[model samples]
Target chain A: MSSKAFKQPWTLRTASSVFVIAWLILAAFPFLWTLWGSFKVELDFFSKADWRNALTGARTMAEHGSSFTGNGYSGAWVQEEFWRAVFNTAIVCFFTVAISLTIGTLGGYALSRSSYRYTFWLLITALIFRAMPPITLVAGYLLPFFEWNLWGILPTTIVVLVAINQPFTLWMLHSFFQKIPKELDESAKVDGCTQFQAFRHVIIPVMWPGVITTGLFSFLLAYNDFAVTSMLLEKENQTMVPKIASFLGTTQTEGNVMFAVAAVVSATAPLFILVMFFQRQIVSGLTQGAVKG
Target chain B: MKHKTFFWFILPTALAMLLFIALPIVSVITQSLFTPHEQVFKTVENCTPFKCTQSTTIDQEATEALREAQPLGRFVGLSIYLDRGHLAFGEVAQAWQSRDGFGDFFNKIGNLPFYRAMAFTLSYTFVVTPLLIILGFMIAVAVNSLHRHLKGLVIFFSLLPMIVSPLIGSLVLFWMVDSRGVLGTGLQWLLSNPDLSLKASTGLTWIMLMVYGVWHSAPFAFVVFYAGLQTLPKDTLESAMIDGATRWQQIRYVVIPHLMPLVTFVALIQLMDNFRVFEPIVGFNAEAHAQSLSWFIFNDLGGETRLLSSASASSVLTILGVAILLSPVLIRTWRDFNSKG
Candidate 1:
């Protein structure tokens, strides 16, 4: 496959190299620009006099006596109390992932082990549930949650997110469990262990890789959610994405766009770290459904 | 697995989906059929020496009590669905009767909120999906040709757009393209029009959003297609080369055919995803120029007045749209399952 016969012509090689380099710039430049601009004052970041001031941070230097200032970060994190949203986000993601994976693992394992036709119907139903946008369901939740005195709370939002996360979590884990052979658990069962005991002894140890991958996705869905978290959670209990959105509504009029800029960077940092650490698992999880189907 | 064991094992998740996903859908339909109770009005006679006058005033307590008694509101049947918000059947009929041509009719229909949203949603979904596929395949092919070490770095950077939250991604791009931001200023300079703003115009806004859509999603397609490329059959490629097939010819005949199934897989997932495009519209603040069904529902649900009935109708309609889009994949899955069984 690596033979000289398969080597590309120089013209084609150059063409592809140029295209890939252009794409890399397009993909990576925005985040880099935003991170850099987030440190500057709003004027320099969105410089009306000159765009180069954004790169040089000229007004940022004039205003704060430094080329780069943490004014936006301080303003967002302290003055606006963006840290509360961060705290709420952490709580939501933690609980949503924990609860979703718990029920999803048990259900997915059952579906994978069973030969019944009902399992097929369940997976198909999950597929349908997964396709419906989360926002559409928000309308139904409002009346009930208001009536039940459950609206505008972290726990309610967490339960809803976990429910919404279930379909994808179940599907991913179902496929992953299918990949693990039936023989191991069967052998344990033959040795006088009950079904639950067989699963506990034989399956749990080998399930970490798949579980971790699925858990990463669950974490992402819970973390990146804006539609459900915005509508269901109270202003005091808002998460990072919705908080950033709220910042836009008020902050833009107050001439404090830098706060939103700083908050966006703050929200994006964890995802950057997640991808950095779990690149392999993320890639595998994405292709898992495609390849298997 | 025995029925008892399986039932116990699946109960928790099944219950969650039922209570949350399935029930909300039913609730939405029910809410959509019912409109909020109208304020109760009481007529009072004011007696004067010269004349008597009658005044009608809203009975706040009575209205509140009525609403409290029946929180589901007054059942309006299908009126809400056919109203100006959801399906806009009346508006469509009016547009059709007064139409000068197909373009004029479509323009009139596009002015309706629901149809306006549908236009953008459908166009965005259709335009972005194939372009991303092509871009993704190109990246996959180019990266596959690269030295092994460079592949890792390129992939790491490539995943960033897709990995970040959509709101954050759009906001990041939105700021960069602000009239005074780098790309915005660059465009102003290049076109020699300092007044040009991407956010101010409908055509540019649509293009900007679709660009964001492709940038955010191409990585998923790239990763999938790259994996497909890894499993390419070397024997077929070698034979094609030996038979004097050019590189382009080999890619056209063999590589593409091999990757066709994966293309369909990526397309199905992207269609589902792009049809629900919501966050980007908010992040870009281009709601004035473009609206999606999700955004329409969000607008109805947000702020001082919840407009629950209107939002619910939109939800039911959006769910129907999703079902239509998803029908092909569901049908394919059913056929595959039937054949296997």
Candidate 2:
């Protein structure tokens, strides 16, 4: 470490430090600023009077006799019923991860275990599906889903999310299951275990690390989904993203901009927490998929 | 495992993909060929002692019935692809025959929906991918250059932008960049021009969208490249130092070649992502000033009048564009698979 430090010249060290500091600031400052401003009244945050009022929280202090208040949170959560979206998002993310992982694990395990040639073509098809945007699928789903009266519910969107998520989940899990030696399964078979028993006993316990990582991604996919949920789900059943988009579309004039701000903060809170807990897994999962696939 | 067992294991996911993913492509292609039926119209004339009166009116009931009877409407083949809102072959020919200047021709082309969205989508994909890659690589190298302990902290913060919902991230940026919001107000003050607004101009809106794109996705690239950096050969670096290589030269000669595969990985993913730059346009409310192919489809399918045919056409075009961009990566993957086998 000492030798490495000495290799860097003073000029180069200063430049890199400057760049790193600037990048951290650029990366973090917007969310931090928005988070702070979410508690302020609209005038203070927006501050047509003076931009400095935003930092100072002048109007927030003036309006509520405090530097910050929960007016926005209350307005969005209680008044606007944004908690419905929170509930919907939870449901969507939960089922999307569960369903995708269940099917993806089986399919991926099969692909990894099999020496058949069609598995290659099957994986290739999944890759192509991954490359296609969800909005394109939404275009097709509109006609059929509407006709079948399946549009606008949580379940339909969940299935769609799981299906769209399959390619990545399958690939990730396939590679992960590949890492477990075939000898483990063969040995289990020699010990009088059926294939399902071999999988249930030998695979599931060892699969959690990869499964959890892939599950986290699936959760993000469902949670972050906007186009499909917006296009498919009904107004009453809108998720957080489409709900926030609706705020952008209609509600600025009612002086309810703070509601949107609070909602944005509320929605982003989980991701912030997710990163805090799973930084290592998330980073490794990302690079593992990229470098390999 | 027996073939039957393997088949059962893979069946559920294959069915899901077939019903949802594969079928959607087929349905989109089918939907694209057909146009919605036109409203039925009738003209009536009455002759009186002094003068004749005539009237034309839409038969709404008949039109509705027609629509109900044939929901997919009449198959127009490739006509929808070449109409004024899409390819606009006729209008383009007129523009060409009129010998309009390139700028004027482009302006006319921009009036076409498909061309306009294509222009933005292509430019956004090309511009954002490279910028994010360079910025991300710089951040990665800088972070890698630091002490190992600070790496975790920096990465935790970096993940925020990339992991946050793109819609939410864009909204956050959009609100901050509103003319009355902090960044916009600060910019106006710094420039001494109160009229400087992101929403008021085309170029500024595009720039803001690109800024949001880089701000959000660059972290993904950074994390990947940073991981790649850890595997850099110690012997090669020590040899470079012994040969009097500067930091820049070491990076250019040794680091980049090693990171090339990772670079392609990032590039492929970024092109696929940036090509579908839909949420930012919606979040920024910049649809009036800018649009993408994905946004075009969204707008058509939305509202009271669902233009299913138009949206499907846009979707097909977008898929084709992705296929074109993705072919190189696909071929490489195929070659790698074959070589390994």
Candidate 3:
């Protein structure tokens, strides 16, 4: 243990605070703004004059009365369309993560354990799939679904969205699962554990951090997936992002302050919760999974 | 016993990948060549002809001599690369390469927006990647000098950008810069001016978006560097320090050379990732800015264009670009793996 920096507490604290605050603001300001924007009224946002209306003061709140509620700070917080977007986004996120992880982990495990002649090729192919742009996949395959009349499968766009994300999930999760030593599996099996049981009891616990990291990433990737979702889903199936984006585009015509309010309401707290809880695992996962790979 | 279980274990992964990831991509490229959507082209054959010629006709009149002429060439096969007059495909495949089944496909890709997208994407990747590595290196060195626990905390903080959904994260930034948001509002008041918008301007927006991309991306770099820093050999660093080397000098000599392998890996992955900068750019463009290749590809999917072929062609181009750019990295990693084995 190299315990060296204890003598210079004040200097270290100041430096760390400066780095942390600046980085946090730059990294998180957009999400914070979304939180605040979701509560604003039409009048405040209308002229683009009140775009700077900070929610810190009571005067702004009083002036923007109908938009601000006690619980949500926005009176019209419970719109059906807003909830529908949230629901739709949740559905997409759910399926995307579920399907991707199951395949990713299984594939990652096989690659890690088996000394196949083409293992490297499989790994590299997975990396390429992960690396290729999502737009390319969506663009290339949008027609196949249309041709199959699978365009009706929640829009041709969603199908593309689901497909594009699969490769990423596979590669990231596979790499994470690979990091656990196989000796643990071998030893567990020798001690009367079957292969599946060894995986369940021995390998899984060790890889939990990786799983969390990968799952969180996949979830974020799916949730934050805007391009494919926006392109694929129509007005009814549009996820939260496109709904918010569409509203932002039509704010003048719609005269709805609550959409921005809705953007804030739907995303802010859940995202913050994810960050606050999974911060450590997510960081390790990123460094190990992406940067060092 | 060994053979049966091994097959079982490997079967699912191989089959899934073959079915899902590999097959679709391979099919996209091949399908583009053979099948032109009936809606978009009359036939893949008549997309553009090799040459043009003038013709004249005279009515069959008594006691009048008439002459007529037309292009005196036979219909060529899809091979024999004829010049398709599109700037997107450029002239590399136009002159001599196109006399095969791949000629029309090459010429078609030559004329599409795919090439411009590739140029734009490659430029974006090239510009942003070095900037990330350099900045991340600086931050990693600065953080490394701090106490261990505190250093870990700082590194984690920097990495939050990686954790958040880019859709939510990037879009939030987009709103924050909007005239009505916090930064926008603060700026407007500070300037005390109406019509002084930050994001509305293209030059500023482009720079700002790049900054956002860097900001979101640098954390991964920082973490990798930090991890490399942790595993770095201490004796070498100590030897440099004992020679009365300054901290910067020690780092430049001892730390950086040690970190090169990690550096190469990070750079290659980032290059691949950045060239595919679809989501963030699309998110930015959704709020109205310049278009990116990904956005164009996405938009092209909806129209009467031959999206599958176009997208496949673009994807193939991107994959090739990535492969070419990162060939050194690939070679190095391969060598490292082989040597270790």
Candidate 4:
């Protein structure tokens, strides 16, 4: 190396730092803006006269005699029954994650442990299914579910979500399980335990962290989904996302956009906190798919 | 593991995938080939010395009887795929015979509902994929260079867009980009044109959708690349420095080659994701200007009419398109497996 080779200059360094920070702000600011706006009155948030009122909540405070108001929240929660959708979402996400992880853990463990050639095909098949848009599958389910009188119910949507989530869950957990050394479970088997017993006594504790990470993803899928839930669930059975969407469709014209706004904030609050706490898992879960692929 | 154990383990998922994923695809294909039976009608006439009356009435009994027998409707045999809503072969042939140039033909064809959605979906996919990759690579590099203490904060915020639901993310941006909102006003001020608005133009709306696409997905790329960067061997980089390779040269030759697999992985994933661009179109209320195949299916399945057959046709086409896009990955995976064996 030449002695005259210059270090990256302080000016360029500062510029790069500013650029990164600016990018982060660009990434995160819109949510914050909407979050703040959700507390204000419609006239202020979507201020026609001046956009600055959205930030300042000027008219909101003037009307309500406070800088912040929960009127939108009340309208969404009480009048719109947004809580129903929230409860439905919780049930759907919980069972979707639970059922998927239960079956997926066993399936993934099997796929990863086996030395047969079918494992490759199984993983490949799952990957292909993972690439498929769930809405397409929703089309298939409609006729049958309708025939079976299973359409438009929370359990129906939950089962469908679990099915839709199975591919990604299998693929993700398969990879995670593959990372665990084969020897631990093999030793358990050699120690006179059956395969299930080996997995239960030896691998369950080691497998939990990976399962949780994968469960987070499954929960995200169930929670964030709009296409399947909206199409599959009856109006009364709608989850938070589809409910918010239905609000936009039905209520947007009625000048009750604030209810939708409040609903969006309520929905986003949990995800915000989830990312804040589980940023590491979310980050790794995202990358693990790429790097391992 | 024993064969019985393996069978037991894979059965549930296999059944689920078979019933939901595989069955749906087959059902959609079958549905595409068939169309719902139309109402049977007959015209009856009554004649008299002074007046004659003719009436066309639906034969409700006959219609219901036929529908009961064939619940899937009448067999159309690929007619639906070739109809006005899908491939538009008739439209294409007419345009070809019109003696117009390619531009005029395209203009006429692009106005067709299915093609219009395809046009936007394809444009969104191609444009968004490259832009996000470049943006992600740049951000990954910058973040990789940042001081360790500040990295966590920046990363925490960066993941929010990717973490949030597509509907919420799009709604947040949609409000901002609305004419009355901050970004739209900011744009108007920048352009010194009070009339400027994203919603008023197709091009601007498309740009806004793509921008949302990039914002939502770039962090996936960034985090992947950042992780890839960590595994870049230090000895090779220092040796490159010793060989007088400039910083740009380092990235172009060494760093890029090291991250090539991850680049391909990200590209493949983003292609699949962007191909199914639905939520943003709905969130932005841009259906007037933009729609994707998924949106096409959603539209068909919803609304008062509930055109199940049409949605099924779109679903089949979408699956075919995904298969085409995914062939490369499958081939690569197969090759990798064979090499390992």
Candidate 5:
């Protein structure tokens, strides 16, 4: 791909480099700044006198006797009991991913293998479902959930999230399954294996790459969700994102905004690691739908 | 596959979507038409002395019984949709009759809660979608031009904003742009307006949200466009260059035509997403200045007295808006599928 014709003149190269650098800063700076500010005292973080105080942790020095402090982390984790939300988040993400992938794999594989006209309709239905904002559905859930005593529980929220995630998970996995050769499964079936057995034995082994990618996305949908979790979960059963939101209500007046900041950083850490490890998969997953279009 | 086998295979997901996604839309529509029962009132007369006063009191038992009997409340038809909190048909008529001009009529309409949210949602969707596409294309081209070793690092950093939860991403930016925070102070210093506050003005708040929207979604466009660029026909590009076309001209003619489908794809997805922009309003604490339709519904549902009817009406409207926005794509998909089949 690298050819002599592709070579850029100095001015264009400089401009491109400059633009990329500027974009990189815009992309990465806020997270970096917030991570730095999370260690500082509130006064220093939202310093009224000078913004540089945040960089230097001037108030943090006066208050905690250090430029770097774990006070916010401790306050959020121990004092605010943010670890409970973390635990709940772990449970929700794990279960949502597991269940979504289980059902999504079956449905997606069936859609890909079948030649029926219904398959197209089902995929289109999923697309329409995907586009409906989850919040609109939340309004529907509240009444029924309250009546059935299904409100404010972790399991209910997990199921709701899995349901909300199905449209996307099905779409992604269906595209992926479509890419695999039909002969792989058809050959296995000719040996007299039942459909489920064929999928279980032959298709399952090779399906991991696609499953893992879909699972990553399911985990993200559950993890990054605010609307469904916030509305559905009980206060005690609240996940990290909603827990952070709840902090704004209670902690703002107490001058403990740093607790929220610390919690935000803590919640983001796993995603950071996920992206670091699964960069290729994440990129491919995002482009999968577009490529199909 | 046999129909029975297909049914068995698809049953679980089908049930989930039907029960949760499909039924909810029905529930929302039903709920939208129904208003919660007004508190049952009883006028009780108490005679003590010469002059006695009679006061009307809410009949707790009756109201409780009423609510218990019919959990969905009394059906109000489309009244909720036409109320002041929603379409405000009456108010629009009044405004139209009294308006000096279109601007004045629009000003009145803008004051309505539903219209206000619609205005912001539409503006944000239209403004952010194109800007993000252009910014994303530029970034993709730039990153594609970079040395191979640096490409991974640039791509990793670029994906950060999009990958982070919209709420957290916006909160991070919101903190920075707080009047006392870094960017806020930087802007003040640049403009030489010590009193300038981004949050305090409507125009600035709208711009801030749109900027955050673009920042958050651009990486998605970049990644898709980048992938499209990988499959670009190098021979065509070479031929264009050989024909005395400038680099820009080659991109204009060759590169863009190849990526046109991807651009449509990105724009369609972005339109659907940006229309439902709710998290940033909460994250930025910008609800006071800007309210999106989703935010409007969230506000109704989250309050102490959940305005179920109001929220449901808004949900129905929002769903209709989505259907309208997605009709073109749906029709196109249907056409393509029919042709292929």
Candidate 6:
């Protein structure tokens, strides 16, 4: 607000910018490498004689490759399997987020408003499940369920994910609900709303950010899950990440370039899409909803 | 009437939780007791045609029959727990080495890879958590001090990492850290030209792992801290500023004290998560010496023997570890909830 404050040169400003730029470079480099690696060809990968040469000469191979070589970036990105993996990831994420949000919110609301014995029990149970090791649950039961015809690929994977995700969401939402003061409930009732009506009309709007954050977390957990998805899904329903992982040890070893590229693309897509669609809600959601007062 | 309404409202969630969460947990705890010793004895009895000899009676068979005849309720008691799994506590206590399982469980644990993996997992969590926390605090403070619009923007940008799928993050990290990729390539040249060898367990590989972890995890902590910062009393902070408190002074005296409750809360959740970490290690380098308790449990449970008992014992141990670590926090929260009620 004063000219005297501005009199000191822009040194701090410049330094801050430089710092931000350096960190961003380090942080964003892996993503850039992934994007570039996706467009590279296999022969180009192998021609370099060794790892170092391959690292340096990958660009050169890209330049000299045939128009429709079908050997490098083009082959991997444009394939049906790639699209299938993407679809499976979407299916898993969508259902996982949607179901997790519903159950968590409903349970959170009940626990928030109701003073019942089972509410405390439910909360504790949810906490225990939230802390349960995901690997043990999947390993011990997933295959056995399939063997006994209690599960199918898509359904089993979905249920396992839903179970894994529900506890965290419940805990998050419950905490969020706890933060909404009892005065708001009283005021809503005073405004002539029933208990259900009060929760639906009043509490829902207030907890929208919490819901969004919890939903986003659920989405992230489901989407990024490697071990559970790898264990549960049969060949046809195998998700994208594990498919790329499977590519690592095969004769198609040179496929690492495309895998890197795809990894960058895949990693950036969901978060980018989420922020783009729900920027406001996600921002406030992240801040006010998670660390309950 | 009030109690009735509350009961009705809580019923659906309580029922679903009981059947799913409560029942499964109780089953896991109960199943930790029953061994397959009975099943083995039954199979042996049906398979053999050997009849009892008067003077030369088989003590082993008689003991096996006694074990078989033991009640299932007693199985839920101490006896069942004693002989429960492939790696029973009873057997493990008797054996000199760790391998008390029927077959290769000892050899499996003896392998350098398993211990190396456990070390990796511990170090990864140990290293990443503090970095993430510090970065989160810096970002939170920076964002908290900005003008409203910019503060909002910073919060939005920081949450970007949290929203991405974990699968995607690990894959992205794998590519960047590969020998021929960006950072990997830079380091490869440095190593090769200088006659340096990049170790699988060290060199660029571990650095890549740490960076990936810090980048991916910082966002969650940042968002949570930022929110906590917002809820802090503005008047106290303003008064501190007016009283000639430096930013650091204000943070130490005003901000941190305000944030302790939340900091502890986030740390507890993160600790539980870090303790059971599976995704990054599993995704980044499946065979890369990175094994946490969760991964070990999976390996044991997935083996040919499917030693659910051993897995159960391990699970119980993990749960106990978590309970011990969080008992203070849990007790405090429970008390707070009760007082509020």
Which residues of candidate 6, in runs, are more than 4 Å off? Answer: A1-14, A42-80, A116-118, A175-194, A197-210, A249-252, A256-260, A289-293, B1-8, B30-122, B142-157, B190-199, B202-208, B228-250, B286-288, B301-307
Candidate 4 per-residue C-alpha lDDT over B260-282 given as tens digits, one digit per residue, 9 for 90 to 100: 98988899999999999999999
CA lDDT scores, all candidates in order: 0.94, 0.90, 0.61, 0.89, 0.93, 0.62
TM-score of 3: 0.77
Cα deviation at B234, candidate 1, in Å, is 0.9
Task: Show the colliding residue pairs in model 1.
Answer: none
Best by DockQ: 1
User: Which regions of candidate 3 deviate over 4 angstroms?
Assistant: A1-20, A42-52, A55-80, A152-181, A187-207, A254-258, A290-293, B1-3, B34-116, B143-157, B179-201, B232-235, B286-289, B303-309
Better of 1 and 3 by DockQ: 1
Q: Rank the candidates by DockQ, best first.
A: 1, 5, 2, 4, 3, 6
Candidate 1 lDDT over B115-231, as tens digits, reads 999999999999999999999999999999999999999999999999889999999999889898888988998999999999999999999999999999999999999999999
Which pairs of residues collide in model 6? A34-A261, A41-A72, A224-B166, A224-B167, B117-B291
Model 6 in CAPRI terms: which quality?
acceptable
Tell me which of candidates 2 and 3 scores higher on TM-score.
2
In order of the candidates, what TM-score does chain B achieve? Answer: 0.98, 0.93, 0.72, 0.96, 0.98, 0.70
Superposed model 5: Cα runs more than 4 Å off: B49-53
In the order shown, what is each candidate's alpha-carbon RMSD? Answer: 1.1, 2.1, 9.4, 2.2, 1.2, 6.9
* TM-score, one value per model: 0.99, 0.96, 0.77, 0.96, 0.98, 0.76
Candidate 3 chain B: 10-residue stretch with minimal lDDT: B63-72
Candidate 1 vs 4: which has more lDDT: 1
Model 6 C-alpha lDDT per residue in residues A1-293, reported as the tens digit of each score: 12232122366445544544444554555555544444445433333245543445454555654222233444445653566777888888888778767766777876777666667767766776776666655434533464467553776677667777776777778778888987787788888988778888888788886888778778767876767777677666877766665555443455555554554475476667677777766656555534454
> TM-score of A-chain in each prediction?
0.98, 0.96, 0.78, 0.95, 0.97, 0.76
Scanning candidate 4 chain A in windows of ten residues, the lowest lDDT window is A1-10
**What tens-digit string does per-residue lDDT give for candidate 3 at B40-135?**
112122333876554444334411221112111123323211223112233644533654567565555534444445545666677778888877
Flag the better candidate by lDDT, 1 or 5: 1
